[model samples]
Target: MATLEGPDVQASDGESDDGEDIPPLGENDNIDAIVESIWVQMAFDIMYVSPNPKDHRKPAYVLLDQEARTSTTPATFQRSDLTGIFRSVLYRELTSSQWETVVFDSFFPLPNSAALKRQGFRAASYYKKWHHLMARLRRRDIVVVRNELRRQFRTLLWVPHPDTDRMWRTRSSMRGFTRLPASSTGPCPLIAINRQALQGTRITLNPPIDDVEQGEMDEEDF
Candidate 1:
């Protein structure tokens, strides 16, 4: 009679700390099972791109570990699928005009390797990958549209405030005028103009003579 040992138990026996032991092969092991496990792990892993506030207009790619509920910034090549998924979500959220603005204003004229190096941008590899993804989006080469409902998506940058008043006040320095009481809508009211305090006195207009030149001619004749 042969005694049976578990795969882990046999592998761990006499293994050194520096190296890991290869588990003994089991009857149930197969290539398909291994590949399926890999695919399942990939499906659970979440990733996205968002604007980095500290880095001005530059975007940051982030990996969200679902099990741990923690996140880390990952390289572009490390997780292209996540980037592709987020790009699709963004495309769906934006209108055609908005998409044009985002593409043209945000990511156009992609920085070259030399420029990235000069600027000391750490995520140069990620940006290169992002550029390729953007190119694909422009070409409409997307094949798989992932379910955005499954993930928590965020924008690459802080979305600007839609309220014009808030945007104006926050963006510009009010130089001369004093900001009055806040209104329910529109900009803060400026200090009211004091009509009573105006300096000039009102003058009455005299009736105009039809022939003022006639008085001048009589004076010359006399």
Candidate 2:
């Protein structure tokens, strides 16, 4: 598998200005929160790739919750949780033919004749015309939707991993999830929760507190 390095942050003379002012990094803020916010804002979904039992070289996609955490202490992510970043980057960089092979042949093996029959496609006819059918559907159309996803993945993974402590780190960015000091014992509110997944109940990193207390806590933390 080819690995792509994260985007270069350095500005080049040929780069065009978007006219938006780059906000100065706030005091005590780290790169992790910024990247997480971007992912949340974009509503990117997470995916995991696992080797097929039938063939180790073939991979399969296992979708996962974007907000799910494997652990709370020194936060860690399952290999499956991080596959989204890898898939997105690979899809963006690979040629259409290569992408198709990766997705259909490896990630999702095409159904065999017996399986195709079960799915209601005439196995014989479908198999005979498979190449022609694929040729009719432009790979560009299928792959275009992934472009934004790939961009977001690259941005999130651009940050270098931070030194590990007891603090939870962002799975994708490999950095502390919050800028809170290691010594601070205050409960940090959960990053946004998935209400639907939790039976419609919300889980917050921090519990509700009085406005004055909240203000004071925010000041001290930041």
Candidate 3:
């Protein structure tokens, strides 16, 4: 169905016709669904810009899992179809102005190559994708009639890569790769010295041996 670009009364935060704070929406109310779904949809929109949106599908699943894990309290609405839920809600409630804000604000810029492989997204790619989606939405929302224009055209960077597994995997590798000196935080000074010697070809002869003694050393000397 072609949705109109007019302002939705339900979406406005306001005093009602009686000039009182709008009654808190009930769990059964569809408005709550719309609000929650808009956020998820925004997240999905950002994800779509990556080199491989489906390639990193686990992030969304992880996001959903985290939501499920942390949601101890009763939620106003169930997130059954995460992407669909977001689309339905955002399409139904958000004004053109709101949509512009959401599209621009919700995304974090893609990271560098090392980070990109880990994240499956690049900043330039994300910006381009988001720009395309915005154009499509603008046409659908009747941008001309709404007198809406997208300004502050740019993407942003987000710290802490989106993939939890990738992040922890990197951290684990760091732990394995790094060696601490006696004055450092970790308790592996000798190991660090050995690794340093191996890395930079730092060699030492025990007992201040001369070249002759070193050359004559047995296989066990190594």
Specify the highest-lDDT model's number: 3
TM-score of each: 0.19, 0.18, 0.19
Candidate 2 clash pair list: 188-205, 189-205, 189-206, 190-204, 190-205
lDDT by residue for model 1 (1-222), tens:
111222311221322221323343344444233323322332222122222235444322122234322233222212213322211111012333443343222322232212222221223333333333222221211111111211111212212111211111121113433221111122221111111221232211121232235546767999
Clashing pairs in 3: 109-156, 110-123
Residue pairs with backbone overlap in model 1: 50-156, 51-156, 51-157
Per residue, candidate 3 scores C-alpha lDDT tens digits across 123-216 of: 3343333332232232333232123222211111111123321211112123323321111221111111112112333222122123235446
lDDT for 165 (candidate 2)? 20
lDDT of 2 by residue, 100-218 (tens): 33222321122121222222122223222332222222234213323433433332211112111211112222122432222223222112111122343322222123333766888
Candidate 3 local lDDT, residue 89: 13
Identify the runs in model 3 with alpha carbons over 4 angstroms from their true place.
1-38, 42-118, 121-132, 137-159, 162-169, 173-222
Q: After superposition, how far is residue 165 of candidate 1 from its true place, in Å?
A: 48
What RMSD, rounded to one decimal, does every model reach?
Answer: 26.7, 22.4, 21.2
